[model samples]
Target: MPWEKQFDIDEVLEKAMTAFWHRGYTATSMQDLVECTGVNRASLYATYGGKRDLFIAALKAYDESGRQALFAKLEALDDPKEAIHRLFWPMRPWHPGLVSCVAVS
Candidate 1:
C-alpha cells in the first residue's frame, strides 16, 4: 500500500525549484533541499532519485513557472515593446540566479 507523509509534493517541489533556481545544481546540496523543502533527505532521495534528478525536476518546474509568469505579464500589457522590456529587462541583473537552474548535466 502507498503511504502518505506530512510533505506536500507540489509545495516541496516549488521550494526546491526556487532553491535550485537561485543556486545552481552543482551548488545546491541535499542539506539545502531539506532545509528549503522542510522534507528529510530520505524522502528527497526516494521521491526524486537523488540530487541530480531532483534538480532536473526543479529546473523543469522553474521553467514552467517562468513561462507562466512571462505569459501573464506580457498579456497584461498593451504595448509589445514595453511588455518585452518588462519581461526581459529585469533579467539582466538576476539572469545568473534564474538561468542557473536549467543545468541538468
Candidate 2:
C-alpha cells in the first residue's frame, strides 16, 4: 500500500527548510529531515523524490516567502534606504529562532 501523508506540506517544508537552513545541504541528512519535519523517509522520498529534490523545494519555498515579505515591506516605504532597511532589518545572524547554515566569522 502507498503511504498516505497525514500532515501539511507547508508545515513540512517549513521544518525541512529550517533544517536545511540550520544545516547546510551537505551536512543535512535524510534522517535529520525526517526527524525535523515529522515526515518519514519513505514519505519524503515518495513526495519529493529525495533529499536533494526536497532541498530544492525547500529553497524555492524559502525564496518565494522571503521575496514576498521583502516586496510587501518595500511597497510600504517610499524611500529606498528605508525600504532596504525594512527589507533587511529582521534578518540577523543567530536570531532567536534561526539557525545558520554555515558558521559566520
Candidate 3:
C-alpha cells in the first residue's frame, strides 16, 4: 500500500513559510522546519524534496493566498481607490497585522 500523509500539507507549508519568513531561507535549517511544522525530517524530505523545494512551494502558496485576498477585497469594495489603497497599504487599522511580502524578501 502507498503511504499516507498523517499531517495537513497546507498547514505544514504555512508553518514552514512562517519559519522561513522570520529566519530567512539561509538561516532556517531542516531541523527548524521540522520543529515549526511538526513534521519529521524524513517526511518533509519525501514530501517536499529539500529545503529549496519547500521554500519554493511555500512562496507559491503565500503568493496565491495574497492574490486571492486581494481579489476578494477588490471584488467586495465598490471604490477602485479603496482597493488600490488597501493593496498598497496593508497595515490599515482593519487589518490584523502587517505581513511583509515574503516573495520579495
Candidate 4:
C-alpha cells in the first residue's frame, strides 16, 4: 500500500524557493521547508531528497524561468534590435529578490 499523499510540486517549489530566497541556504532548515512547502519531513526527503537537493531544484527552476523568458525575447522576430534592447535594457530590470538569488549561486 502506498502511504504517500498527493501534493502540488509547483506550489511546493514556489514556497521552498521563497523560503530559501528569504533565509538563504545556510539558514533555511528542513523544518522551515516543511512549514514553508507544506510537505512533511519524511515526504520531503522521499520526494526531493535533502535540503541541498531541494535547494538545487529551486535554483534550477528559477534558472529555467529566466532562460525561457530570454528565449521568448530572442524569438520575437518582428524587431530583433528592439527585442534585444528590451532584453538588455528593460524599463525595470531585474527583480530584487531574483537578483539576490542569482548572487547566491
Q: Which candidate is the best by lDDT?
A: 3
Model 2 Cα shift for residue 95 (angstroms): 24
Q: Model 4 over residues 24-64: C-alpha lDDT tens digits? A: 99999999999988789999998889999999988888889
Ordered from best to worst lDDT, the candidate numbers read 3, 2, 4, 1
Model 3 accuracy (lDDT, Cα): 0.90
Q: What TM-score does candidate 4 get on C-alpha atoms?
A: 0.73
TM-scores for candidates 1 onward, in order:
0.62, 0.68, 0.75, 0.73
lDDT of 3 at 93: 61
- Clashes counted in candidate 1 amount to 0
**CA lDDT for candidate 4:** 0.83
Report the lDDT of model 4 for residue 30.
Answer: 99
Worst 10 residues of 4 by lDDT: 96-105
lDDT of 2 by residue, 1-105 (tens): 866679899899899999988888899999999999887798899899999999999888889999898798799888988886665557764476554423431
lDDT tens per residue, model 1, 7-70: 8887888898888778877799999999999999998888999998887887787789889997
- Which ranges in model 4 have alpha carbons more than 4 Å from their true place? 1-5, 73-77, 90-105
What are the Cα lDDT values of the candidates? 0.82, 0.85, 0.90, 0.83
Going through the candidates in the order shown, the clash numbers are: 0, 0, 0, 0
RMSD of 3: 7.0
